[model samples]
Target: MSISPVNCPNTDCYWSAHGIPDKYTEARAWHLAAHRAEEHGELLTAEQVAYATRAGHTLPNCARTAAAVAAAPEPIPARWDRTVILPEHPNGDLDGQTIVCCITDDGTKRPIGLFLDDEHREALGLLLVDPNGEDEEHATLLAEVQRLKTELAQAQEDIAFTERNTLPELRRTVEHHQDGKKRWRDRAQKAEARVAELEAERHTTNEALSDAAQQLRANSDRITELEAELTKYVGKEPTIAEEMEYLSGCLNAVRDLCDATEKQATRWEHPLPVPEWVETVRAATDGVRPDDPNDNRHRILVDGKGNGWISVCSDEGTEWVVPIQPAAHVEQDVRDVADETGSLREIGRCW
Candidate 1:
């Protein structure tokens, strides 16, 4: 089925400025009209006007009125009830008259020139030109020329429409895509920078952890050496007297070594650490005397079991003795005070 092409009511529209041909489809006509309304400020339909109004867009005065007229149906011509009269040609030649006709709904002949204005009459005259005594081939060539002219005009109109309506929208679309791409690129650059920063931080942290691990290993080795030295000093349990004797020998050996090194003009760079047991023996033996009857004097003494005693004696015999509990070793300062004062008062105070 053939579709009737819709003519846009806006006389200023591109489609209306150009004539609609038989080949112009209904869909194409509406599409062009819609384009003209949107891009050219010439609304051709009632719906477009209403939409523009609701969207708070002001349309041109000409377009606002044209939309309503476009929505209304085309007026139907009144039927001719009386007999028609033919007008005389100005040239006074009936044979040369160019008559335009139309077939009504009832299949009766009607003069189309009655409805046309001067401009349309001139257009109809061109179309109705008589091909007097012209060959069939010449007529065919003329028809082809007319058809080509119509097609060329249609092509020019299509090009103009595209340039006016579609090109700007395409450019805007391209710009929008470019902006999106730029934003994404900026985000990517930031992400890359952040990743590099984190990587640098991780590298520094790894170096610190490696240094700590090396230091820990060195500390572990020092601890192991200290444990070995401790074990060598106190490998087995011994009596207090034997332990004291052994520490005394070690002290004499260290003193002899120092004396020999000094005599030879030698130096020792790193000295050995003194064992803790040496301090224990020194505390136990401080202000204590050896067992000797020949040297009769008042003194403090320590036994093998770490017990203490105060031996007070006259030139003739031992007078009094005070026993002290184990581990209560006497301080050398208190003994020196007792000896200097010729009294046991300081010693008693200490006890």
Candidate 2:
């Protein structure tokens, strides 16, 4: 098929230079109608409007379109001859015998009149006489096939575009999502481990607390025992340090008292006033001057009447009291000793 360039005479029309018109006159006539419809609102001829008004029928165009049609020139008619090559007959001997006539728009034929025999010519006349329906069917099928081929090419382009531009980006998006998922999984695992560790630490802390509570109870019981023992033995409650110090002090005081008593017994003395007679007897008797002057018998016996006496023996085996002067020096010495040992009374607290 050959394509001819069909253009609108009006450069302002949308179809002015676009190459889609199949026939020149048809495209030109359409553009002229479009111009009249747009610029003048003229679609019907004056005669058509009058006829519609008389018949009471509605028409789509105004009567002014008849003037546009009057100004536009009529398109020149052209003859178009469409041909199809028929297939050869399967019987090669009869291949050249068939004849096909050229089909016209009105379903008529003008034969080229080429014939090899009268028999073939008669057969073609009969066959080709059928009003061009077969030719139209063939053209319709050819147009359908062309449209399908164009659709197939467009589908292939779409497939190529998807493979080149869309698929890789989708793959990368999936990979990115997978990586994010992996990172979240790792974080979750770490969190789980941290939770377990905290639980274990809490358990250990609980055990330690249990042990401390037990030890506190034991300490409380021990304190109670110590307090009881203090009340039982010492007849009073006292702190252990205070009781130990008090007992140690008492032991020291008793030791001091014992030493004082031993010293006083070894050196017997008195700090009271001595009578004159007791001193006279001590000074007069040479034989009475004993080796130990601290003896109880040698100590002077003084009466409350300021008189002194010495125990004596007579020839009749009777005891006699003789008047004597007491020694004043020995009395003073005993007074000093008694004063030094006076703190012995404090030992009574031990009871």
Candidate 3:
């Protein structure tokens, strides 16, 4: 828009105020602008609005800009940059249409409407056809696309790093390390079950042995009592009643002893299990309890041979079956004392 003011005949009157009123020139002359129709009732069509603006009578003030457009006499929006009458192409179709842009003439108060081919119009559609801007929207969109691409790349890199390094390590811990723990747990469970069975058998055997021992003690006492009675009777050259009573007492003692002997025989029939059953239990465990005290170490067994196993043992000497050796127990310390280190050094040298 140029600043050298031209004389406006209807000065401050938005319309041209001097053009012939036609189909497009709804109204003209000074401050008053009206959409006077060639026919009544219909608001001026957009085609009419453009035509009127170009004629310099309808919206003469708008040089494609609304304020400039409002300077026109007519009440029309500036969405219409301009309009063009279509011309027939050599192909005989009106397919190649011309779009007139209401380009503001820098030095003149007039709107310089220029023609655009169909292709240009399509491009203009992409760049808003109004205000006649180009590629501005696409430029904004392109920047957003670039930002998304950069973010996506970083995310993919993080994923790749995890797969190559962190994920593999995690998987190894889960699959191999954790699996080893499960195997140990299973072995421990088996050992425990065996120990329980052996313990039950041992309990029963001990109970029988105790009963036998009690019976034997009772029998011994009875025999002593009978001997005392016989001693007194022997001195008196014991009468028939005394002799008979002593004999009866001796016989009763023999009978009690016999019962005790039978019970003891049965009880002792199954001897205490050899250490191997315990060792087997331990060997079954491969006896390595690095975490417990030896005093807590215990052996369990079934009464019969080859029938028992060891449960948890405190002694590190025990062994258990495993694919790999059990991990050595580690002691956590904030720091090893210097004196302790010196002692260890001396021990190492001596050893």
Which candidate should be chosen as best, given TM-score against the real structure? Answer: 1
Candidate 3's TM-score: 0.24
lDDT of 1 by residue, 119-217 (tens): 544543433344243667556766887998789757755665565346546767899999999999999999999999999999999999999999999
Off by over 4 Å in 3: 1-140, 216-351
- Give each model a TM-score: 0.32, 0.28, 0.24
- lDDT per residue for candidate 3 within 38-91, as digits (tens), equals 111223445556655565443322214334345669632333354544445443
- Predicted candidate 2 versus true structure: per-residue lDDT over 219-333, tens digit per residue: 9999999988787878556764465456546655655555555555556465334444544443332123423424334234333232334444323543344445554222322
Poorest stretch of ten by lDDT in candidate 2: 342-351
Clashes of 1: 0
For this target, which candidate reaches the highest lDDT against the unseen true structure?
1
Mark the regions of model 1 whose C-alpha exceeds 4 Å error after superposition: 1-174, 243-306, 310-323, 326-351
RMSD (Å) of each candidate, 1 decimal: 19.0, 25.7, 38.2
Clashing pairs in 2: 276-325, 277-324, 277-325, 278-324, 278-325, 278-326, 279-325, 279-326, 280-325
Off by over 4 Å in 2: 1-153, 223-351
Model 3 residue 112 CA deviation (Å) reads: 32
User: What is the lDDT, from 0 to 100, of the residue 193 in candidate 1?
Assistant: 100
Q: Give the Å shift of residue 267 in candidate 1.
A: 44
> Candidate 1 has what TM-score?
0.32
